[model samples]
Each structure stands twice: as C-alpha cells, then as structure tokens.
Target: MQREPLVLESAAGPHTIINSKEVVNFASANYLGFIGHEQLLNSCTSALEKYGVGSCGPRGFYGTIDVHLDCEARIAKFLGTPDSILYSYGLSTMFSAIPCFSKKGDIIVVDEGVHWGIQNGLYLSRSTVVYFKHNDMESLQNTLEKITSENKRIKKVRRYIVAEAVYQNSGQIAPLDEIIKLKEKYRFRVLLDESNSFGVLGSSGRGLTEYCGVPVEKVDLITASMGHALATEGGFCTGSARFIDHQRLSSSGYVFSASLPPYLASAAITAIDVLEKNPDLISKLKENIAKLWTGLSDIQGLSIASTPESPIVYLRLETSTGSVKDDLKLLEDIADHALKEDSVFVVVSKRSTLDKCRLPIGIRLFVSAAHSESDLLKACESLKRAAKIVLVNHI
Candidate 1:
C-alpha cells in the first residue's frame, strides 16, 4: 500500500510556511531541506513506485530489499565505518543498542544530561548505571578510574560510555576526543549517537568523528537519527562488521519492528550525495550558527545556553511564565512579523513545562543550508524585538 503524502501546497529552498489547511509547524527535523531537494524527491519517488510504500517484515525476515541493502552498505562507507544497520527511528536504534550488549553487574556510564533515550535505556538495562556531568571529560574519567581502581572485584563486569555528538535541546556538543582517550585508558566501550551531527558537519558530513579528526574505526558503536539532517525518516547504527552482526542478532528494535521504507532508504542515499556535492551548504550552516552565537553574545538581555558549534543554537529567555505561556506563541508572533509581516522565517523553540519559562532555558534557533545571510540577520533582529516586547512590557 502507498502512504499518504502530506501536501504542503508549496515549498522552496529553506522557507516553507506550511500555509495549508493542515498546520503551520516548526516541529520538523528537516534541518537541511533534504526532503524537497529535487534529487531526493526524484530518487525516492522512483523507489516508491518500484518498491511500494513500506517493508512488510523485519530486516531479518523477508524485508531485505536490494535498495535497502545498498543504502545500508553505502551509509557505512559514508560514515567511514565498516558496517551499518538501519532502524525505523533514531531513538530506537540508540536505546535498543545500550541494553543489547549490557547485563546485570555490567555498568552503563552516561552523561547526566544525555538524551532521554540513553537515560531510559540505562533504566531498562540490567547494567548498573553511572551518570557523570554533561560533556565533562574529567567527570567521565573520574567515574572510570573509581570503577576500575577496584579491578579485581570488577573484573567480571564491564562498562560502556554513551553520549550524543550534539545535544538536541541546548545544542552543546560532547567532548568525544577526551572520551575516546578515556576509553583507551579505562577499557570502556563507547556509543555515540550522531543524530544531531550527521549531514550537518565535517567535509564529508560523516559527523563529529570526522569533525574531530577521529578515526571511525576506533569507535566501537555509533547511531544517528536520519530525520533531522537527512531530511528523511529513520535512523541507523554503524560500526565494525562484528559489532553490527551482534546488534542485528541482539537488538530487539531491529528484530521486531518493520524495516524502514524503501523510499526513505533511497532518499537518504541520494541526500548523502547532495550533501557531498554541496560542502558549502554545510559551511554556510556553520556561518549562520556562528552569526547567531555572536549576535546573541552581543545582546545584553539573554543568556545563550552552552555555546553551540552545530546548527542548533539556543538561548535562555529571561522572561517569566506570567510574561508568556508556550513561548511558541511568542515565537509565532515574532515569526509572523519576521515571516508574515516582514517576509522572514524562524523556528522558535517551545516550552512545555511552567518552569521552562525562566529556568535557564530559551529558544533554539535552527539554521539550514537553505537560509541566507539576510534571513539570519532578519531572524536575529526579530528575536531581539520579541524578547524585548515580552521582557520589557512583561507580556
């Protein structure tokens, strides 16, 4: 059966107001405008017409299509790893991997502010859990040293370190280089969820490993969400042939869930090619990020969250809830002036909890290869205006 397309009425480079009867949305993960790219559209359309809508069974079953296999193989090469496996979603690949290799007495060392997927996985795993400070290498090393110092008692059990290349919320990147160094010293396995970094970093866009000049061959495990950077649906886990083999055999998410759609696989591969051909888009994205960072720093009103080197940049909105409920509306109001009134577009981050109002939190300014210098300046201008309107008038 074919899937229903959510027609947007229209879309251009990076700005799609989604003015359909459907909904105006900022909840999208299409960071680089990959979905509307003609290359991806044509390739995925061809695959859909050729392969149908969805896989009928799991990959281990009768669901392995030639296109799917090719996509998986090519992803490994693209990421500089020997092997890769696809999952229906990124969180599934990441969460399921943690528990697959660990068991009781084994310890899962995690960053305190890791994505909820890691936190939840540790809760479900039989392994004892240890959480160090977010992106604090010394904290990670201290935890490792404390555990391994009692080597004889801990000999039967093992430890694994898990973190993301870029945090989804605050956009702060993890210190993988130092973590890798600690792995060598402490004998801990590492899993890096490259969800927020892939297709948005490095010359080849292989993610943080490449950005940091680390060899993928040395990293034991890697996982990523395709939805964001790839402008497609699904996720993937990549590593050595042996590790992938074990994951395929052991990961429940891979075994039980329906495999990713063939069209998505085809589109993802083509999307990677587009990224490779246009290295400058990646560079431009960085420029936008840098501009946003610099602009925010110069502003005396707001506090930028942990400075981001990636596409997702956030700041701490200093207004109270009495000032605004669902900052999305304030952002939407700003977007109207920016997009509607002034013909500019920006995605304003939303706040779900009450404490989120002034709890050292703020907006996530997303930039893509599709945005222009004028667009970024416009967004910054709008953000500053909105912040003042809400903060000064205490709206």
Candidate 2:
C-alpha cells in the first residue's frame, strides 16, 4: 500500500504544523534554528525587494550578480580560505566539484558510508574509485598503501582522499586529524566535505578543519552546503584561488546552472554576520545537545549512535526485530507512533539497497538550538514510550 506524504503549510522550526497537526519537529536540518530567524528573514526580504527573485541564466552567461560574489567572499572570509564558488543547489556541489578535478585516469579513495551525493559524484568522475571502511583510520591506511603500491609505476596518475567531516549516514564525526596524517604519509590530496559540520562545529563555526585544529591549507578542496546551519539555499566550495578558478570554469553545476537567487545570497551573508556577532548561538546549541543526550541516556530497546556533541541523534534498534525488512518496518512504526500518539515528529533512515551503504537503519532525531529543555524532554519521553510499545514483541 502506498501512503500520501504529509503536507507542511508552516515554516520548519523546533515546532511546526504537519498535516494540520502541531508537532515537535525532529526531522528538519535547521541546526542553529536560523530557519525563521528575524535577521535572516529581514535580510532576505530586503534583497527580494532590491534584486527580485531569481537569476535568469547560468552563472557564465550574465547571471553572476554582485550578491553572489558577495556571498562567496563572505563565506571565504568566515572560513579563512582564499576563495569559494557557489552553486544554486546543495547536492550539485559535490557532483560537480568531484568531476572538476578528478577524471577518468585519476583515483579517488572515499569512505563507503558517504551519502548519495558523493556516490553520484564518484560515478560521474569516471575515476578509479576505492572504498575504505567508515571512519576507520587503519582501513584508510591499508587502502592508501595498496593503491600507492599498485600504481607506483604510473607517474601520470593523480590521487585524492575524499571524506565528509561529519558523515550524514551515521552521524559520526570523521577523525580528520588522523585522515590528514594519512594523506601526508601517502602523498594524496585531501578533498573534504563539511556539509553537516559547517556553521555547526568549531568555536567560530568554521567547520571540522577548525574544530580538529587542522590547517585549512592542508585540505586541497573543501565543499559544504549553506542550506543547513546557514539557513540558506546554496552550496559552496572553498579552497585555494587556483581551485576556485578551476571550478568556476570546469564545474558543470556552477558553470551551467543559474546562480543562486540573490535573496538567498543575502540571507547567507547575514547568517555569517549573525554568527560573528553572537558566538553564543553555537554555545547554546552545544548546551542543548548535552541536555538532549543526557535525557535519552536510559531508553530501552534502543542505543544512541551519535556523540553527545553531535546535533544529529540517531536511535538504533538494540537488536534486530526480525529480518531487514521487518526491522525497517519496526523503526518506521516507532516514528509513526511518536508522531500520532505524542505529536512528536521524527524520521527513520530509509535508503535504497542499491546505494551500497553499510550503515544501520535508525530513527533520526535532529536537535536544534531553538529546542527548549521542555522540548527535549518531551521528545525523549515520547521516543522512549514509542520504542517500548513497538518493540515489546521483539523483547
């Protein structure tokens, strides 16, 4: 049987109306609660009035506006990088950026747990792709050694190590410090995706490189999205001036797609400005994460799969309820029960088997800075209750 998707007629926040029912929202990516922020709203409104809605053509064909350049420069400054190139859509950033540098003859060693975007990019790159175990430094070392040893005679080939600073599949932070050490040891260029970490990690929200104390120069190419914590609708790649220049001309997404809407560029710029002025927002988010982690500490029939500092909290089955299909159904039922009985909206990770991911399925509960202590407690309590009811037979 097929089910109709619920319609949301309200803005996504800590609380929202779904199917005309008010629910505590745990399915959104508004990590810093900037989705409905007043300053961001005001900035977008002002830009809309001044620049109107959309850019009519591709960035290469008279679509590059001042706001687009401003936003890219602002992001570069915030991250302390030499330059950045913007894309209208978030996923396109990876799909385009990968092929921009890596091509048919080169090699890209990536984590197996990377999201669909990276997978698609790998396909498009036509490169010799190698997969390492998820965040396993030893596995990465072995893969690099094997590849390097096999290709030692191929002087013309290029090599790259690609990974996400914070993995979307498992909600785990990549040990970037170790990855960098391996990159240096193997002489492979590092291409990092900070999509989930940017504007959420680090003291100043400069992403995992900053949080891990890895110098920006160590990374050859870095890509991220402004749609999450930045509360904007575009993506960016920040690195050396040479890298940015190459992407401007060679990256298909940036060269062929219409530039980001000017209002969104304004919103992204304002988001960075706000982050600069109020460092406490990150601190507040940290506090909220700690509170939520502590509250969910004792839930039965479930285990927490994310770190306490991670804004994304994943609740996995303590044991398989049955087969894979049956387990997936149980997880989704828990989410549905949370929504129907307790008015708490949550999500279960559902992916096509074709994706080749090894991560476990779980109920994904996204925590935000906007969530109050009461909201955290409500969600935790509801999740616990729902898990108990749904898994009673399995237990």
Candidate 3:
C-alpha cells in the first residue's frame, strides 16, 4: 500500500515535529542549520517591512530591487566571480542557465548522475547531449575525444561540459580538478551545478572550485541554489560579467519570471554574511558528518555511498534486490520504521517519474552543523534496527 506523504508540524531543523512527535531530522538539506536562524529571520523581517512581500513584476520591468542586486554582487564577491545573475526559483536556475548559452547545434557533455533539473535544461537547450560515466574522469576524456573526432563541425559550434559538484542523486563529489584539465585540453566551457556543494565542501564554503583548489575563473559558468546552504529561497548563476550580461538578456527564467522577493534576497545576503563571519560553522558541519559516518559504519546490509566530505550521507543496500521498485520499497520501509518507531526522520531516494537517470536507489541522510553527536547516534541506531527488521524477512 502506498503511504501518504509525511507532513511537518514545525519548522525544519536538526529536530522537527511530525505527526505530533519530535524526531531527529535527517531529511532536509539545511546544512548550516540556518532554517530559522535569528539573523536571517531578522534580515527577512527588515526587508519585508521595507520592500513589502513581492516584487510585482519581472526583473526587466520595475522589479529589480536593490536587495536582489546586492545579493547577486555578494555571491559574485564570495565566489570571486566577475558577476552573477539571480533567479526567482532554485530549480529554474539550472534549466534557464543551461539553455541560455547553449542552443541548437551546440554540444553538451554531461554526467548521467546529474539531477532532473539539469536533465530538463539539456532537453530544453536542443543541443546534442552526450553522457559520460558518472564521476569517471577517464570516461569523460574518452567521451570528449570521441565527440571531437566524430563531429567535424565541433570547432564551429559551442561545446559545454556540464556536471554537478556534488551529485544530488548519489552524493558523490565530482573530480573537478581533472575535469578542469580536460576542459582546457578540449577547449570546452564547463557549466557546473554547485547546489549541493556551495556552502558544504570548501574550506571557506566557496563550493567545488575552492574545494578542488581550482581558481574560480577556471569554470565558465557556475550555478547554485541558495535553498541548500544559505537557507534562502532563490538561486544564482555566477561567472564572467559578459556571460551574466548575456544571461540577463536571454535566460528565460530570469527574463520572464518575477524577480526574487526582496526578503529572500536579503536573507541570502545575510546568510553569506553569517557564513563568512563564522567559518567554524563549516568545521562543525564536517565534524558532525564524520560522527554520523562513523556511527553508520556498521549498518547491516547497507553501505555508505557518499564521500567523507559530503554532508549528504547516502546509504545503499549492500546487495541490490534485483529490481528498482523492490529496492526502493525496502529502503522506504526502513525509513518509515525509523521514523515511526524510533523517532528518527530519514528519507529514501524517491525519484520523479520524469527522472530518467540510471543511478541506484538509496536512503539519503542530510547532515547538518546543528546535529549533535547524540542525535547522529540515535539516527544510526534507529536505522540499523529498522534495516535489520525490514531486510531479514526479505532475505
């Protein structure tokens, strides 16, 4: 039987109220624990009072608020990019930014493990899309070589290599250093989605480029959703000033959609300020992730799929049940048992029907700086018990 969607009765954080019971939350991507942060709340309130609730028009019209420009500039400065453009919605950032520069007859080499937002963007670009093996630099090189050799007009048409810094589906960090070398060798522009890694990976929370020690200018385009690390509602694309200027005029989402609310923009700006002031937040988050990984090391019939540096700790069955549906069901049962019986909230990798990626299904536990060692221990113990109960019968 299909279960009804779980409803939250309180604000999402390290702990949340669900069905009148408080549980340790591992379902949200609140990496910095900024959901109800006092500073961000105060910023939102001040902006709300000053600018009202809405922008009332698209950015091209009278909707370009001062806070939006400040947020964009702040992001550019944070990432060391020449400029950046903001979008009202997070998911739309990928779809709009991808198709903005890539048009028909262009070539795009992408990772198969990228999220649905990027998949949709590639489809909309009308470009010839090619998929390399997920995170396999050798496969990327081979694919790029094949494309270069096979297509005689490749030099004439625009070519882009798109990937996610930390894949949402598998929680794997991309080999960005190797990717940058390949892009330079093949003369391809790189469009990286840093939604999952922006504030989580780097030493100073500047995303993949900083994490990999690659200069910010190495990437041609970089986009990230503030929803993940910043705990804000919109997204931004950062790169050269010329590229941003072009996106302002051509990107569908930025050109046609309403400007992001002033409060959200203010919240994003404040989030950055908070992140910069307190670099220790990243350290605390890393420590929490380490504690969770250590606790989950012995989970029965399951294995960790995420990298040590990743906040998204993905748990997959040690052996597949041979069917995606069956595997998903088992994972869901474990998640449900952990939530209902043990008061630990977790989630399965529930893919959209529209998503055509071939990655395996698993359970994803989003770790946060706010999660205490005790909270992680509780989650680990609960998951272990739930997994044994769910998998024993199947075995």
Candidate 4:
C-alpha cells in the first residue's frame, strides 16, 4: 500500500502539527530556531508593504533593490568576505556559482558525497571532474599529487578543490584545516559549500572557517543557502570582489533568474541581526545537539554517523541488508513507526535516482535550539522503540 505524504499544518519548528496532532519535529533544518521569528516576520511584513513580493525582473534588469544590496552586503560582512552575490533560490546557488568559475578545460577535484546541486553544476561546467573519497584528507592529497605528476599542463589548467563544510548525506564535518593545508600545497583554489554549516557552526555562527580556526580569506569562494538557518528563501555566495564581480556578469542564475523577493531579502538581513545580537542561540543549539547525541548513543542495530558538533544526527545501520532497497525499507519503516506510534517526526535518508552518493542509508534527526530537553528525550525513547520493533521484525 502507498502511504500518503505527511502534511504540516503549522509552521515548521521544534514542534509541528501534522495529521491534526503536534509532533516533536526532527526533520526540519531550522538549526538556529529562526523560522517564523517575530522579528523576521515583522521585517518581511514591512518589506512586503513597501515592495510587494517579487522583484519582477532579473537582477541585471531592474530587479536589484536596495534590500538586495543590503542583504548581499550583510552576508559578506557576517562572513568577513569582501563581497557577495545573492540568488533567488537556495539550490540554484551551487549549480550556478560552480560553473561560473570552472569551465571545460579546468579540473575540479570534488568530494563524492556532495549533494545533487553540486553534481549538476559539475556536469554543466563540462570540467574534467575527479572524485576523492568523501572527507578523506589523505585521499584528496593523493589525488592532487597524482594529477600534478601526470599532467604536464597542470600549472596551465585552472585547478579547484570543492567540498562541503558539512556533508548533507553523512552529516560529517569536513576537516577544513587539513583541506586548506592541502590546497595551498597543491596550488588549487578552494570552493566550499557551507549550505548546512552557515549560522549553525562556530561560536559566532561564522561557519566552518571560524569553527576550524582558519582565516576566511584562505578559501577562494564560499556558498550557502539561507533557508536552513536564516529561515529565509534564498542563497548567497561570498568571496573576493573579483569573484563576486565576475559572477555578477556571467553566472547564469544571477544573470537570468528573477531577483530574490524583496521581503525575503529583508528577512535575511533581519535574520543576521538576530544571529549577531543573540550569540547564545548558537550555544543553546550546541547544548541541544549534545543532549540528543548522548540520548541516541546506545540504540541497538544502529550507530550515530554524524559528528558530535553537527546539528544533524544521523543513525545508520550497523550492517547493511545486502540490498539498497531493503535497507531503505527498514529505515522507512522505522521512521513511519516513530511518527505513527510515538508521535516523533523523523526522516529516512532517501536518495534520488540521479544522486550518486555511495554512503550508507540512515535516519536523520535535525536538532534545533527550540527543542526542549523533554523533546529530545521523547525522540530518543521513541526512536529506540521504533528501531527495535522494525529491526527485530526484519531480522
């Protein structure tokens, strides 16, 4: 029997209404608890009254508003970058920004576990793409060395190393310090995607560079989706003035797509304000992450795959079922049982047909600052029970 998709009847937050019942939400990436913030709402309302929703044209063609420039400047200042360019949509940022710099003859060494947006960008760029083992610094070093030794035109061809701050599929944090060391040694420009890390990591919410104690200027480019932590509807790329200026004229998404709604741009600016004023929100989020991680430490037949610092708590099976479909079914059953029987909303890591992720399937729990200790406890107990019921039956 086919199952109906669960409909959210309320705003996505620590607790959400679904099927007429409120459930502890572990599926949303509202990491800083910014979704539906009062201040953000007010800002959006003000911008809406002034600008009325859409920008009505591409950024190049009268769609650029004061709020857009303000939002871009705000992001750049927050990240300590020289400049930034904003995109109408979060997912479009990766696909557009990547191909803008890399071209057919360039070489891009990428992590295999990056999201589909990056994969599509690499495909579109028509660059000679090489894959390194996900988050394996040694493998990346080896790949770079191999490329340098084999290609006589290595110095002539543009070289780039692309990786995510926090992998979406695995929830593992990349070793940015090590990656920086390697990029310098190999003479490759670094392009980091902080979609899941921005406003979530670091004491001040400056993302991976701050978390790793590396200077932000060391990385050539950084891209992030504001939807996760900002609770807004767009994305931005931050870098040197040269990179931002080049993208302004050539990036397909920025050049052709309609500008981000003025209200959303305002919301993003207000979100940054909220983040800066309340640094304690990041600390609170870390506390919740620790509580959830400790609670889920001893589940049977599964192991936590995410790092202790990551807001995303991923639980993968200790052993695969010898088939991807079977493993996914087990995970789905566990998630469904948790929702139906325990009233805790969780999600299975289901991959698209186009996704080439080789990582193990798992159940992902997105922890939030808004989650109370009781919420974490309830989710832990419910998932433990669900995993036992589902895994025991499957065996």
Clashing pairs counted in every model? 2, 0, 0, 0
lDDT of 1: 0.74
Writing each residue's lDDT as its tens digit, candidate 1 over 4-64 gives 3233555534555454432223335566767578899999889989999998999899988
TM-score on alpha carbons, each prediction: 0.86, 0.97, 0.99, 0.99
When superposed on Cα atoms, how far off is each prediction in RMSD? Answer: 4.8, 1.2, 0.9, 1.0
Report residue 35 deviation for candidate 4 (angstroms). Answer: 1.1
Residue 105 displacement (Å), model 1: 2.2
Per-residue lDDT over 238-308 for candidate 2, one digit per residue giving the tens place of the 0 to 100 score: 99999999998899999889989999999999999998998888998889888888888789888988867
Error of 2 at 99 (Å): 1.0
Q: Which stretches of candidate 3 lie over 4 Å from their true place?
A: none
The TM-score of predicted model 2 comes to 0.97
Please give the lDDT score at residue 375 for candidate 2: 90
Stretches off by above 4 angstroms in model 4 are 1-3
Give per-residue CA lDDT, model 4, range 1-395, as digits (tens).
34566899999998999999999999999999998799999999999999998989999999999999999999999989999999999999999999999999999999998989999999999999999998999999999999988886556788999999999999999999999999999889999999999999999999999999999999999999989999998899999999999999999999999999999999999999999999999999999999999999999988999999998999999999999999989999999999999899999888778887778889999889999999999999999999899999988
